[model samples]
Target: MIRLALIGIGTGHPDHLTLAAIKAMNAADLILLPRKGDAKSDLLDLRRTICAEILTGPTHVAEFDMPERAATLPYLDAVDAWHDAIAAIWMREIGRHLPDGGSVALLVWGDPSLYDSSLRIAARLGSVAIHVVPGITSIQALTAAHGICLNELARPVLITTGRQLRERGWPDEADSVVVMLDGGCAFQGLAADGMSIWWGAYLAMPQQVLIRGPLATAGPEIMARRAELRQAHGWIMDTYLLRRERAAISRDAPTS
Candidate 1:
């Protein structure tokens, strides 16, 4: 039986790796690293660095070029097709390296249970036993970097993507929203009144940048900074938390 372990590495930080992640890496018979081409080679380099620093076993490491999604197809169809291509590549690599079926590991960014689709891709490998090791999410990193709570006092938080936010506007009854995978700064479209935003780019990394204030004040700043960072780094992975102010709840109102 093939044992596939999807280990979350957390924001590409070596220290963010959990003990279980390390053990899984060392125990794996082979580790597959996907290179995202020259534009995002830094991502592949980070994975290599983590393996070099942590692997004490004789695990074989292999690198493959990642498949790019088709821009012409509709978003959902494009993503579905892209995942299928990735799964095929994974199977081909696994067969080539571990012909007899052995343990394999793929280092995933953040927890796979989040917006990440590593788990979904892995499910394509029929009959392969899978294990997951949770790691810090970008949301946690953003909140920690800003030193703020994820939710307002007794209020709920909603996590969505820039595409959804742009198309649907702010979700009904959701005061706190976390946005990820936003290539376009969608927050600028929203009415900035009574809203606060805490934004972070490259969270938990040496090149991390953070900005926070009323949306009216910080919205433009974040847009400019995001542009500059993307130009400098060739790519950027950022997430932000947006909160719409609500009626103040009395401190004595319900302790339970």
Candidate 2:
């Protein structure tokens, strides 16, 4: 039986690793880390650092080249195909390393329940006993670094992707939205009348950057800074939460 553990490691920060995640890493028979080309070598480096600090058992570490998604297909379709390819690569690696199928672990960036695919890939393993060790997420770090609560009292929060925000615009009833995986500043097109935004890039890491204020005023600044940092580092992992003001909500609502 394959005992698979999906361990959340957070945004490349050594401190962001939870004790549970560290334990899980040490318990695994094999650990797999994917290299997504030279542009994101930092990801592999971070995994290596984590392995150095945590893996105590006789665990074998392996690196596999991650497949890139084709840009020609529809967005969802392309992502689905990419994930399939990733699952195949993982299967190949696991078979090569642990033909007997023992305990294995993959260190995921941020919590697996969030915008991560490690858990999904593990599900494709079939009949495996799966375990999830939760760790801090980029959203958690974003809120903590900004020193703000995620949602207002008695309000619901919607967590979504950059693509959703850009394509659908703001949902009618959402007062607070946490946007992740946004390559473009989707919040810029938002009606920023009285909405406040808290943005952070590289959360919980040494190279963290933050911006917060009324969206109208801070939007451009965040966009400019995001571009600068992305150019400087060649990659970035960022998240932001936007809360529309009560007054602005009332103004946007039509009178009955």
Candidate 3:
């Protein structure tokens, strides 16, 4: 049986690695790293740097080129096909390296359970026992960096994607929303009135950027900065938290 461990290495920061993540990396017989092309070479390099820093034993490391998802297909269909392709690659690599099946690990960015598809892809590998070593998520990193709470007292917080926020406006009954995987500044599309935003890019890394204030005032600044950062780095990962003003809700409420 193949024992597969998905170890989360939070936001490419060496210090963000939990002790469990470190132990898992050292314990693995083989570790697979996906190369996402030249534009995102820094991502793969970050994985290499982490391995260099913590790997104590002779664990074989392998790198595979990632398959690009077809942009022509519908979003859901494209993602499903991409996951299948990734799973195939995983199997091929594992077979080539560990024909007799032992423990193998993949370094996941942030926690595997949050907006990451490593777990879903691993499930396709029939009969493999999966283990997860949780690391700090980008959400945690964002909130921590800004020194704010994730949710207001007695209010529900909705964690969603940029696509969802764009297609469907702010979710009803949610006072706070955390947006992830947004390449474009989707917040720009929302009605900025009565909203506050805390935005961060490259959280926990040396190149981190943060902006927070009334959405009306900070939204444009974030868009401009995001473009600059993406241009400079060739890639970027960012997330933000938006909270609706409680006073505005109270003012809009109809008297009983």
Candidate 4:
């Protein structure tokens, strides 16, 4: 039985880690970092930097090659197959490094409870005790960078993926929508009128870029900036929030 610690590293920023995350890193017997090839070497490097800075104890660091998802298969099937492959890789890495079955840590971006899949992958490893150490989420970082509240008073905020936003358009249940894992800029598909948007790329990172304004006016700017950033970095992770005009009537509405 292995004690699996899924530690949130918080947007690749060293300062974003919480005290609990710091303690978890120091307590782990081994740390597994996934490498996503040349295009995402920066991510691998950032993981390395985090470990080097915080893993003061004699914790072993293991780097594993991440498997790519199948493009041909349907979304759900493809995701299932991809998760299976990742679980296999994770098991292999763990067996090779710590055959004795000890504490292991995998640093995740943002909180595991959000759009991250670390928890799902860990569930595949049966009989393992899973512990989550939460950290600052991209949503939190994005809102902070823009100095805006995520939701309006008496209104609900729906956090979803780009695919959902594309397929469902604007959800009627939510006046405020926060989109994650949106590689194709799905917001472009919706009508920009009466909607305000705040977008951030590489949130809390050194090369972070933020844009906020009316979607009609600022949407093109975000697209251009996103294109330029992606071209320069070879990869990009971005999130955005879109709110309808009526939601802004009372910005200071009570959240509780």
TM-scores of all predicted structures:
0.95, 0.96, 0.97, 0.95
lDDT per residue, candidate 3, 123-239, as tens digits?
999999999999999999999999999999878999999999999987877889999999878888987779999999999888999999999999999999999999999999999
Cα RMSD of all models vs. native, in order, equals: 4.0, 1.2, 1.3, 4.1
Clashing residue pairs, backbone N/CA/C < 3 A, model 1: none
Q: Candidate 4's residue-wise lDDT over 65-182, tens digit each?
A: 9999999999999999999999989888888988999999999999999988888988898988999999899999999999988898988999999999999887766779999999
Candidate 2 residue lDDT tens string, 2-58: 888999988888888888888888889999998988878988998999899887769
Q: How many backbone clashes does every candidate have?
A: 0, 0, 0, 0
lDDT over C-alpha atoms for residue 210 of model 2: 91
In candidate 1, residue 216 scores what lDDT?
95
lDDT of candidate 2 at residue 8, scale 0 to 100: 90
Runs of candidate 2 with Cα error greater than 4 angstroms are none
Q: What is the lDDT of candidate 4?
A: 0.91
Colliding pairs, model 2 = none
| Best-fitting candidate, scored by lDDT | 3
Instruction: Give residue 35's error in model 3 in angstroms.
Output: 0.1
